[model samples]
Target: MEALKQSNPGIVVVWKHKALVDDVYYSNMEVFERVFWTFGPCVEGFKHCMSVICIDGTHLYGKFKGTLLVATGVDANFQVFPLAFALVEGENISSWSWFLGCIRVHVTQRDGLCVISDRHAGIIAVMNDPNVGFTEPRAYHRFYVRHLASNLKTHVRRNDMRDMFKVAAYQRQERKLVADMSLIGQACTKAIQYIVQVPLPMWSLFHDVGRRYGICTTNFSETFNNVLKGARFLPIMSLVEFTFHRVNKYFTDRRELSQTRSEQGLAYSPKVTSIMEKNIAKARYHKVEAYNRRLHIYQVETKRGDRIGRKGGHRHTVNFQLRTCTCNKPRIFHLPCSHVLAVCVKYSISERPWVDRVLQSEAYANTYAPQFSQDRTILGATD
Candidate 1:
């Protein structure tokens, strides 16, 4: 622990032990139960990433088996950004509470942060507790749609259960969500009861208020788990060393890439730029009609095109002041949709303000700017 702190200043390392009882000998050493650690660079870099966090736990293998809990964020380029890691005896209320508590203290205290995870009883309890920082005002707890769909499958016998649930879960409009839910109900009446048991906001994007950033699953954390699959079988100390090197590489590689992109005069990161380009192309055919100049409100009507035969053109209302479009894409994804871009084109206004700051190239560079310690702390390893 001292060595870790010495090599990586600002790194957070917390460990817990089993409580001692009166029956135990006084001289007996405390039994180590779990340890949680987050690199200094990761903690700092997360500020430039999205506010949404995805957390999941996987079983570790080999000698001294345990469960590895991971928390990850998504960068501007939509890449996985590992935040914190923990090695616990198993998944339980105490372990999850301790892990989440450590994250709140050492990681981020940003309000309105969204955390995505499975329907684990331990996680539910930890997030529901008012004393924990995962609750409302401090943070929001959201259920991963994949997990909810998985749970729904236990009750509904339909083969297309996941697809139906996804249509409901990913809907940006409440009316569309209700329509999708009704379709599910028509197919499997039993599913409606189980689905309604969980709050709409908990599993559906329509009520997420843009906190989810369109991410409906814990796939980022799961990807990180796959990246560290080989290290999980090693001893605890070896695993820690492996994790340091892996995360260091993650930072270094992305840092160089972002610097290169910034030098090339890119405004937004790769994913954001791609989305903007697509929206701009689509906006070419949108006809905008100004409503209120002071309020920056306009009605954008999509011109009939080749695909209009099946999917008719849509007329959307865009409000620059509120940064919203009736299509719900801008508010939900924090980027200007085709209709919103159409308004910008008509008024000759710059669309930069419409984009989320975190999705910008500057933020992408900041996310990977922090450098990890160069010193290799592996046992009996030379520089």
Candidate 2:
């Protein structure tokens, strides 16, 4: 620990120790109760990523049994960017609150942030506490739909019920969500009752503020937890060292990939390009019925089988001036959906302007531009 501090002076490493009484230490020798760490490079790089973050805790299996709490951010390209890590004695209200408080102060001090996590009682309580909870203007807390589905299984127990619940959660329009939930109510009234007990804005995408940025689950943080699965068995310092090297390699590789794509003169990241291509293909099936050039409003009509609604075909309202579509995909993703694409094609307007700047290659490169410095502790000090 001393060596690490000396090598990386910018890294924030916090340790909580028990109070000594009568100028004497305890005999048990468990001096440290909790530890939190956030590398300097990660702190700097997170500014380029989205304001949304996901947090989850995993059990450590080493000689010292404890919980590993991890918080991760999402980059413009939808890649997972690890932020901070903490080791606590257990997963409880106090532990989670302490960890969250540290993150709020050190990492995400900005307002209008969104946090995603499972519905753990501890996490929920901490996030809802008026004094400590991230609420209203500061931040919004969202529940992971996948975890909710798992809990719903105990009541519904049917694969179709799970599928319907997912459909309702992912719907960006309240009408569509109501329709799907009605279907669930028809099939299993109990499932609908259970889901409605919780606020729709907490889990449903339709009512969420624009901060979610298309992420509906805590799977990204879980994926990072899985990446460090084997490292949990090592000692605390060893685990930290392993994570440092692993994250360095991750940033290095992604930086190279982004540079290669930029050299190709790509406007957006590969994932965004692929999604745009698919949307363009779907756009061909829809035709623009009316275009008010002065108003920048368009009315598009879909063919019989290309519509998303229950009806055979439907008309959508697209206002390029406001960068929105009645279907709600454009407003949610900050990208032009198929309907908007069709309108843009009819007007001969380049879709590039409609694309969100965050999805572009430049943002992706900026996210990984910070370099992790080598620790002199690992390599002997230079003359």
Q: Which of the numbered candidates is closest to the native, going by highest lDDT?
A: 1
The C-alpha local distance difference test score for the whole of candidate 2 amounts to 0.80
CA error at residue 297 for candidate 2, angstroms: 0.4
TM-score of 2: 0.90
Single out the weakest 10-residue window by summed lDDT for candidate 1.
1-10
Which parts of model 2 are misplaced by more than 4 Å? 1-9, 20-30, 304-312, 376-383
lDDT of 1 by residue, 1-383 (tens): 11223334645566666545456744456666677778889999999999988989989877769999899999999889999988998898888988888888878888889989998999999998877788897788898898788878766866588679988899988789989989988988788888989988888888988898999876788789878979878877677778888899889999999988888989999888898988898888888898999989899988756545635367889888888888898888999898988888778999998889999999999999998866544322211
- Cα lDDT of all candidates, in order? 0.83, 0.80
Across 1-383, the per-residue lDDT of candidate 2 in tens digits comes to 11122346546666665545457877665466777777777887788777888999999895878999999998767878899998898999988998888787667687777889988999989888767748767888888898888789877787788778988999988889989988999999889999999888788888884678778876799788877879889777777777888888888988998878888888888888888998888788887876687888888887756446525367889987788888888767767899989987877888877777777888888878888877536322211
Model 2 alpha-carbon miss at residue 143, Å: 0.9
Go through the candidates in order and give the clash count of each. Answer: 0, 0
Q: Which regions in candidate 1 have their CA more than 4 angstroms from the true location? A: 1-8, 19-26, 308-310, 376-383
**TM per model?**
0.93, 0.90
Q: Which residue pairs come into collision in candidate 2? A: none
